[model samples]
Target: MNYTDEEICTQYGDRPKDNRGAVSPPIYQTSLFTFDTFEAFTHAQLYERENYVYTRGVNPTTELLEEKLALLERGEKCKCFGSGMGAISSVFFSLLKSGDHVLFVNNIYGPTQQLLEHLQNFNIEHSFSNGDVESDIKPHTKLIYVESPGTMLMKVVDLRKISTIAKKHGIYTAIDNTWATPIFQKPITLGFDLSIHSLTKYIGGHSDVVGGAVVGTHELIDRIFTYGFQLNGSVLSPQDASLIIRGLRTLPLRMKQHQDNCLRVIQYLTTKEEVLKINHPSQWKGGAFSFIDDQMTGYSGLLSIELKEGGFKKVAAFINQLSIFKIGVSWGGYESLVNSPIKENNELELIEQGIGTGIIRFSIGLEGSDLVIADLEKGFQALHSIKS
Candidate 1:
């Protein structure tokens, strides 16, 4: 029987059958599969092509995660990878070529920008879509890559409008939808050709595993499945895929608590005497960062806050003083994390986004809201002492 996407996800992503009686899906942890006969081997490998040749090509555990991811993104196909960068780089290499110009959004993930630089070093031309301008698209532009609510600073881009412009210019649109998970935003439904995710974040939920996924039209996925994935070979391990699958079961629940905590935290920050700015989408004036649109209902666990004075040094002091939030590089895990760009030479660039040296990015966790708030308040008290 054919199952609906939601039913398929519930059954396969989380709610497995009680035949074995285990609630969680078991990790296959296998590297290879065998066939019964020579004819069967040929059928699986060459003629019929129904068998798995290598773990790099496919795994049952990874396949389960891919199926759920395709359902989550409302796409026909999905590809899993070792990390978010793997997925993104595969998409780039699959779709782009030398001399093909790319219109990429500014304020994207740091690693992505680094990748683009490396691509440029390899002769692929790229242009930054620094401001909201469609006139920048050139005839050679082949792809428009965007990451809405990007990085430590939250900056939203009009995906639909950009899609229209890209279509007119014959450019394919792709997005790093990590900030707005599928539970809140579906980039495919909003006109993106491909949507990529760092499943290590919200999808993995606990931040125990590192993985990424690309979900999109069957045609685009087919190319990646055949060309990008086959050659570069950054496939997600079967064990990691199991972690993401298990995490999917609790995504909705965890995201709700994350939003609740962020709302309270952002609201409190807005009222703080020392806070200079808050970059949460809830505070945006109906631009790309505004979550009032139909594309998003709830915010993710991440949000950024700027202090009135002191830059990264004070932000670092506050972080060192914090008891609950750990200073880390990544977010979207069960625990909280905070970081800033205070030490970087790009401090002025971040400051341009209303983020100061004292600006601190917070990833809310499943911890009790009251306790989280008290911990943050103590950090703020420390910040005040630094200023005094």
Candidate 2:
């Protein structure tokens, strides 16, 4: 009667009973579905949110992916979008009205902050807070948006604290759960109102697909579906949906391998003189990160390291020296990647972020741990030569 997480990933919501019993879920590639009768067509339009009307509103392929994602996150409803920002924008446009305020916690994604700045044109406002939730809460605050193990530093905010505060004040809370995925952290179980993920990352496993999803209660999700999803028309294609489903089938196996490789890399970094600090959940040393184990079962391979001393040229030198790791952006793939938030012209912003120019974020891939560590050793040598 009981099924395991791997079973849920591979088996749940996928039954061969339909579609001529094809072992793989067939892609319903049509733009719209037709009803046999006009009366049936009207009925479908009336219940467009639940019925198969058009691909813009719903598609069997995307819907299957949505159902699986909702189940994975333990949420009631779900919506898929063309990109992660599309999902995020829909959530913002659907839930927020004129003059409403949003409270951003910890280090949020750069593009997300840019989107919030854009919203200011419509009279919506936001405030970024480290941990002082009490000071930031305003009378017009409508939502508390946060990212755990966020951005480069991997700063984690207390989800329980955020949810409880939001509920006490009648505010909705949402989290970017892409880093942890549903495999490690279920925001709904932690009392968050909405959980968002960039399926282009780990859920897709491969870098071939670019999609996003939002999961939460039926009421909120339906509202987003109407305004943010259907009306705005950022829809996920059936081809992408099928691709994401294939990725989900091996999520358990891929995630475990990523974690194993990351931990090994972290251990090696801790022993190096060039590494000033390792920014990842497992390496967190203080009580501030104590709830990590309680909230998450595991972590992703994404992490950042601060060099003992460096600037833009030094960091660039280190990254340029790496062979196995490719210098790039947008992680959560089978290939290792390297990037830096610190740039030559962003000194003031870096100071505001409280990070140095020496930070390098790494996205460890399925490659062996020994290969990753050996490349990093070369990168450190490049860092040292910069002094000359």
Per TM-score, the best of the predicted structures is 2
Clashing residue pairs, backbone N/CA/C < 3 A, model 1: 311-357, 311-358, 312-357
Q: What's the true lDDT of residue 378 in model 1? A: 85
Which residue runs of candidate 2 sit more than 4 Å off their true CA positions?
A: 1-3
What's the CA error at residue 380 for candidate 2, in Å? 0.9
Model 1 agreement with the true structure over 212-309: per-residue lDDT tens digits? 99999889987897777878988799988887887888887788889988888887777788788888776776544453486676688798887778
TM-score of 2: 0.98
What TM-score does structure 1 among the candidates reach? Answer: 0.92
For every model shown, what is its TM-score relative to the native structure? 0.92, 0.98
Candidate 1 ranges beyond 4 A from true positions: 1-9, 13-23, 47-50, 285-292, 344-355
Worst 10 residues of 2 by lDDT: 1-10
C-alpha lDDT score of every prediction, in listed order: 0.81, 0.90
Q: Which candidate is the best by lDDT?
A: 2
